[model samples]
Target: MSRKVDLVADLGEGFGPWRMGDDAQLLDILTSANIACGFHAGDPQIMDETVRACVERGVGIGAHPSFPDLQGFGRRDMGLTADEVRTDVLYQFGALHAIAAFHGVPVTHIAPHGRLGNLVAVREDYADVVASAARRLDPELIVLAQDGKLADAARAAGLRVGIVGIADRAYEDDGTLVPRSEPGAVIHDGEEIRRRTVRMVVDGVIESRNGTLIPVACDTVLVHGDTTGAVVLAQQIRVGLEEAGVEIAPLTDWLE
Candidate 1:
């Protein structure tokens, strides 16, 4: 059977003169674009430009919301409560929604960025906050939890859940992502990513850091657009997946 996957490019990086990522090149390689809302990275102009890029390329667009941390780039953990998460997500999503509206594009999904994303992946309350906030904004919007229990919780909350299957980082038995600071945390080898992603898409399973096989259902695959070799990696992965007969599609298309 041929495999199908949704490849997303993370867009909307930096604020003002401080730029990050090869978003333009990455957009050429990805099917969906996760644009950052103001809090974490991206100003209004950056957000508007990212939205237009997605529209021009026929790529799906989503809000990449994060904690309000420009200096830390939203990588530092803030231990925010559910209420805080709700408020933060609403604020950022609203910003991106307005920009998307201006571009005549509908925001397709919500992917939590950086530390906030990690929090929602494992923390039940935070996941609820994300789902609740999204539902409050628009009940039709999809909430991308992309990991373990949160995926189930998002679904249970009556929100459309997009599971992000392959992890570039490791995960604990409990399913919380292995902190990037930990040893053997992030997987950078191109071959490894290719192999792991194959198993995830074709077999509906993924190997953990301990070499244990775990069941995971994924609707979308995230390719970081802010990385140094992002464009190359995204291109390689797309080519590799296609060569393996895996069909590349956008998350929104898959959901539809």
Candidate 2:
């Protein structure tokens, strides 16, 4: 059987007048996008344009909900209860849903952003609430997450979970991503990232910081668009995957 995976990036991450990355260029290389909702880094106009562009390109649209932390770009850990998390996520998800509906496109999935994304991997209560909110909103919605609390909670709630393998990030031997605050948490070398991506998608494994082989079952690979040379890195990854005989497709098209 041929190996198939989705290439996704965080989009619509600009608020008001500031833009973060070249979403226009990155969109050409992506099969899906996790667009930010208002709470983190998006505004009404950005969301609308992002969705319109995604619709035009036939890319899968997924909500990227974050904590109510715009100042921190959703990277700050606010001490909120699980209920707060649920409501915040609901607000963001609903906003995106309305916009997508206006464009005649249904949102195919949901992925938490930044700190919320990290917590969902280890914090079980937060993960459960996120999963429950997604279930309550749309049972058919696929939950994109790395293998952790969110994946487990989503699965238990009968939601389809698409494992996200990030090739540009470092992982521990235990199969969890290293915290971003730590040194060397993110890989910068272009050739290294390309190799890691192909290995994660085709070989089903990635090398850990400790030189251990951590097995990963990836349905989608995240390509960060905000960093330096990000578009170039994304282009290289796609070429590397195609060269390795991996079939790239949208997550909604293949994830079940």
Candidate 3:
């Protein structure tokens, strides 16, 4: 039997006049999209337009919430309390949900963005709050996260979980992603990205920055739209995965 996987990308990471990635191209390639919900990058207009594009493309819509750090692009760590985290997530999710509803689509999942996402992977408190917030808003909402505290918290909260593998980012020996400040943190070579993606799905293992193999469960693969040559890289990864006998499906269809 062929293994199934979901291809997702972060989209709608633009504000007003500035756009981050080639969203149209990425949407054409992605099965699911984690759209920025105003806190990190998107504005109301961008959110509405993005939701409409996703709906037109038959892509699954997911909330990409983050700290209220538009300046840092939500990539900077902020000291937020559990209550703050919960309410902030709730606010962002609600905005996206409303926008998606207006477009006749449902916001099916929640994936924390940037620094918040990294924190949820390791911080039990942050993970618990994010999961709890999702459950409270909609019990059926899926939580897309890496294999760690967020996944555990989502499962414990009775919400469905999707383990996401980042194709371009380098991982650490401990399974965490290497900081962008580190050299060789983000892989730019398209062939290398495609190879790493195939190995993660077929071999269930990924090579860390330190050249150590770490076990990983990949239900979905994320190709960041903002990365250089992202469109070409995504196309290559998809083709490679299919050639390797892996079935690429949408997160709603494949993620448990």
Candidate 4:
């Protein structure tokens, strides 16, 4: 039997004059792209360009929605009601959908960003709202999330779910990601990342920060595009996965 996985990266995370990562290089290396919608780090022009690039490359396009925090890049948590969160997500999705529509590309998935994403992994209400928003927008849209509340809510809401594995972030024993403030939370060693990525895809397991072996359902591996040496890291992961005999495919192909 052959093992298959999707390689994904966050793209279009740039504002008016400032850009975050080498989106062009990362796009070429990824099988799927979680494009930033307006709230977190993208504008109309950036979204349009990103969609066109994805169309040209035949890459899977996904909506990356986040809290309404541009200064903090949506990494700061806010106290908002369920309705507020739902509408915020809907707004972001609508913007991305419009841009993708203009470029004649189909948005196939939805993935939360930063603090909103972290909250969805643990908070049932947050997860429900995000899942509900995606369901309302498009029932067929796949929800890319970790193995937690968001994934469960998405599945329960009759939406397809893809379990995501963050290759550059450390995990807790309960499968949650370690807080970024903590030391060693984000893995930076290329060799270590490559080895761990291969193991996660091949064995469906990853060692937590506390040295606990946790079983994970990894449908896709995410490489942060904003990190230093992100393009090189993505290349290393792709090559390592292929070398380990794992077929790299898009999330849409693997989603149920």
lDDT of 1 by residue, 148-195 (tens): 555767677777887885436676665566777899877888778877
Best by lDDT: 2
Off by over 4 Å in 4: none
Residue runs of model 2 more than 4 Å from their true location after superposition: none
TM-score of every model versus the real structure? 0.93, 0.98, 0.98, 0.98
The TM-score of predicted model 3 comes to 0.98
Question: Which clashing pairs does model 3 show?
Answer: none
lDDT for position 2 in model 2: 79
Tens-digit lDDT track of model 3 for 2-89: 9999999999999999999999998998899999999989999999999999999999999999999999999999899988999999
Tell me the TM-score of model 2.
0.98
Clashing pairs in 2: none
- In the range 1-256, model 2's lDDT, one tens digit per residue, is 6788999999999998999999999999999999999988999999999999999999999999998999999989998999999999999999999999999999999999999999999999999999999999999999999999999999999999999999789999999888889999989999999999999998899999999998998999998878788899999999999999988999777777
Worst 10-residue lDDT window for candidate 2 reads 247-256
Instruction: Report lDDT (CA) for all predictions.
Output: 0.80, 0.94, 0.93, 0.92
Specify the poorest-scoring 10-residue window by lDDT in model 3. 247-256
- How would the candidate models be sorted by lDDT, starting from the highest? 2, 3, 4, 1
